[model samples]
Target: MQINKDRDWEALYLANDTFWDHGEASPGLVDYL
Candidate 1:
């Protein structure tokens, strides 16, 4: 799926519309960091 980078996903976090959030850093992304 394509993501909308223009929208502030952080605002969704502030508003608590975070059903899609995993509540932690993604394990798949740990290596990139």
Candidate 2:
């Protein structure tokens, strides 16, 4: 799963081509902020 830096990640998410946590905001990010 070597995603290129130039790739459009938003498109992949919209197309459901990538894995992700389908829930609330990321806990780690919340804690960091």
Candidate 3:
């Protein structure tokens, strides 16, 4: 099935649902130099 990614992201932002984000990255990721 095809889903509208932009619309879904807008909904999340409008609803203030930020559980998917954190101030820092996970262990496996390295900082951008």
The lowest-lDDT stretch of 10 consecutive residues in candidate 2 is 16-25
TM-score of each model, in listed order? 0.40, 0.49, 0.33
lDDT by residue (tens digit), candidate 3, 1-33: 245565577777678765667767876676443
Q: Which stretches of candidate 1 lie over 4 Å from their true place?
A: 22-33
- Minimum summed lDDT over a 10-residue window in model 1 is located at 1-10
Candidate 1 TM-score, true structure as reference: 0.40
Q: Tell me the number of clashing residue pairs for each predicted model.
A: 0, 0, 0
Model 2: per-residue Cα lDDT at residue 27: 81
The residue pairs that clash in candidate 3, if any, are none
Instruction: List model 1 lDDT by residue over 1-33, tens digit each.
Output: 347779788998899776678788888799789
Q: What is candidate 1's CA lDDT for residue 3? A: 70
Q: Which wins on TM-score, candidate 1 or candidate 3? A: 1
Name every residue pair that clashes in candidate 2. none
Model 2 reaches what TM-score against the true structure? Answer: 0.49
The lDDT of each candidate is: 0.79, 0.80, 0.65
Candidate 2, residue 11: Cα displacement in angstroms equals 0.1
